[model samples]
Target: MLEMLDNPQLVKIHFETHDDLVLVWANGAPPLVAEFVQVKGAEADKLWSVADLCLRKKQAVGSSIFEKSLDRDQHEETACFRIVTLRPVVSALTPLTYKRGNEARAIDCDEMVALKADLDGRMPNVVSKRGNGTGYWLDNCQWDARHDEVAVKTHNRMRLFEIMQAAGSLLLLEHIDILLDELRKLVKTAGDAKWKPDKAKKILTRKAFLTMWDACLAKLKDDAAQPSGGKLIEKMSNASLTGTVVAMAVDMRLDYARSVRTSRYMQPDEASQLQGRVKSEVQNLSAKRAAGTLDLDGPAFHALCVDRMDAINASLPADQGDRSAFLKGCMYDIADRCLLRFDRTGL
Candidate 1:
């Protein structure tokens, strides 16, 4: 599928007996020595193995050469050849021949621009670093191949992670509403005259809540920046990336809620009620997951949480009283935590 074309731009190649050479040809065309040359005679087959070893070892140290001198006299070319190890071949004219042949015709700005555009379309960004050396060959033939594979795997993992984060976020928001409802009832039953139901919405929109959400979002953004993998095994392991993202979201929510309560809004009794319910939920979910009784997928976890919320609501007092605002805050905390964990971990 690959082809080479010649243009007015001159390219000269010099042969070096000290180093290995590969004769590249078009798919249907005969092997023609333009600038590069094939092995003198019997060394042709060894070219492939040498290329492979060069790429693998990342060194130019030569091993034994494959030669046909055993059966053939110094003059004749023989088909049969064998590999042998020795020091690298060196010749007096190798350097001079290469230096002279590297010179090419000067190009005007227009031609240079066009040529650069052509190359940009064909090669990856990394390939532009090499002009016309062995480094270019290594970049295009070896490193680029590996990089492409890693890029694909990384993208897949990030895609799955995003899905999990989104689902978890939705679940947490719903749970937030349930927690608020429960909190209102608890406040009312307490007969705490100081509690203000009217201020609940204001509290929900407080700077503290916004700050916590911002922190959680920042963490998610950082996760999104994780690099991709190159190996097949790594790509396949991305199956669990989504779950891991979800778990992290849950952890962020829990930590934020705790920070809010402990730092600026200390309400031990109210916070304790919310925390207790969440602790119980986690324990129950953990047991269920361990026993293979609950599925961690979106539908299953959401349904179970909804049922639990209904039960929690029914158990609360009829009137939320003056503590309605406090209850709503607690609910918000619990819901976010539950949603995050259930969404990702499937528990």
Candidate 2:
């Protein structure tokens, strides 16, 4: 599924079909190619052999793994086949392993002769009736093995994280968990039994999948933008803040308010003057943010505000210049009062 998402050429995925999965690829119109995939979860110690592939339940004709893989040969569109498993293949099938530049593996002379002879004796009509010879089927078949379920999940998570980063998603790890769960539910729903036109519901098209992905990302961003309760916290929420910074912002807002009430080390006039300066700087930063001249994201925006406040403190008269922390608190107090906003304008 991760592979399907990564490939731009993939058009649709059909789950629980004649094959375990069918990946349809097309450039524009009707001449789509289908890659039929048969997924098998083999025992930990098992290795797939020629005999295993040729075996059929009740020794029935057209029921062997190879025959089932070729069933789609009767379809109009070009077809390729794959047997994806959790166990490795024996020596004769080693050439079918999926690797870079090795999507298809042709049977060698010796193995082809022996295997073809055996299959012909078991299912001669099936071999002779293929539009292309049995050799073509063998050449197009791929055997991809050792796909451990747990390892695949880990890989898919890493792939999803990369996708989020590429999309500039502000979501964190917990959010990724939520998104993955939602996506799994979507896959399960798509896998449910449905016929003909309704089977369209069973097929996940790339365009539709991407639309859902984009909508999920947009909702996460919207949810993050909503006010998170306390006055200062609400202001910080606009900035997309979380964890320690939010707690720190709350503390700063309270301390700055307390200092204003008691006039701890500074006079009332000094506090008022400092407040005006902080407001001026914030306005300037807000303008820059609006103009898109500052490209910083949420946390970077917060850090930039802190640095600007520290610079403001340094420029003040000696006694005032020493109170950098107090100035930072003053900034948060201004935010609490709605006189300052950490987020970019119109964002």
Candidate 3:
């Protein structure tokens, strides 16, 4: 399952648990913790319906901003958060007549902040809870005080992994686009197409991408190092590195298009479409691998991309959008083809 996550744009993994997980938005932002209504046994179903209705109402009524604090930046910050409680369906032993109040409870915004602080202190190396723990697996945490030798070194390695994960999330596409702009200007002013290829090739090399990925990967790896990051880092290898590089290049193109001055100048839908297609195909490949179809980059992949491109071109409307979008299409084709070939042929 871990190996399957080759490239993720936005992924939310659901876990079965009663422990509340806090979501802290961009920095200095008040956290939001989803509150579940307690529903015992069969009453859970009724509460789930009620909670759904409440969420719909909240959406309809709209939210009003509430000022939380004015920080040292002189920015008058306002935070508007709503607490939602849902009684989700569990196992047969945890039946449907379950009332939300009996089965589950949600922590408020304040409680979430306190929890974050507590978790940060107690599980200094741990990031967030991925899932539940059981008997022999009770000490399932990534960071353990018990294992002396493996604990310390592996913990640091986990930190690096978290750094990479965080780096991936940081949305450095904007910076890449900015740099691309400078590169374009330099090329245009020089009036030398010959020079441009050499310059661009230098920018888009494995070494360059690796350097940047290392920096971001380090940051992400650190943030979730101890338990979560350790698990993730253990999954990384040459194939993972290649996927990361491909994803970064695609990300650069997407970011560039999003920053175009006019909406027509860059169409995000194109990139989004391509992203969706690639993600689906990758997932399918992962499924095939699981089913004993170990040849990931076989003929199946080429057919997938060919079908994908046909769909993309079919959906295109007559408009000259950003070059990056077109470039991305080609990049996706080449990257996926190469990835599959590499997967099949090996390094």
Report how far off residue 187 is in candidate 2 (Å).
Answer: 1.4
Best model per TM-score: 2
Give candidate 2's total backbone clashes: 0
Residue 55 of model 3 has an lDDT of 35
lDDT tens digits by residue: candidate 3, 1-347: 11112223112211112211111122233432222112122323342321232232244331211010001112122211222233332221121232323322222334333433443343234212322211111111111012243554444334433342444432222323333344345324433333345534222323443454456445433432222222222222223433554445445434433333123333334444645555565556556765666554434554454455555555656574324354344434334334333234332
Q: List model 1 lDDT by residue over 219-335, tens digit each.
A: 544432232121212321332334554444344444544343233333333445655665576567657765778756644654465466456555666663233333333333344
For model 2, give the 10-residue run with minimal summed lDDT: 98-107
Cα miss at 262, model 1 (Å)? 11
Can you give the lDDT of residue 7 in candidate 3? 26
Best by lDDT: 2
Runs in model 1 with CA error above 4 Å? 1-267, 320-340, 343-347
Off-target runs (Cα >4 Å) in candidate 3 are 1-43, 48-83, 87-269, 276-315, 320-347
Estimated TM-score for each candidate = 0.22, 0.60, 0.23
- TM-score for candidate 2: 0.60
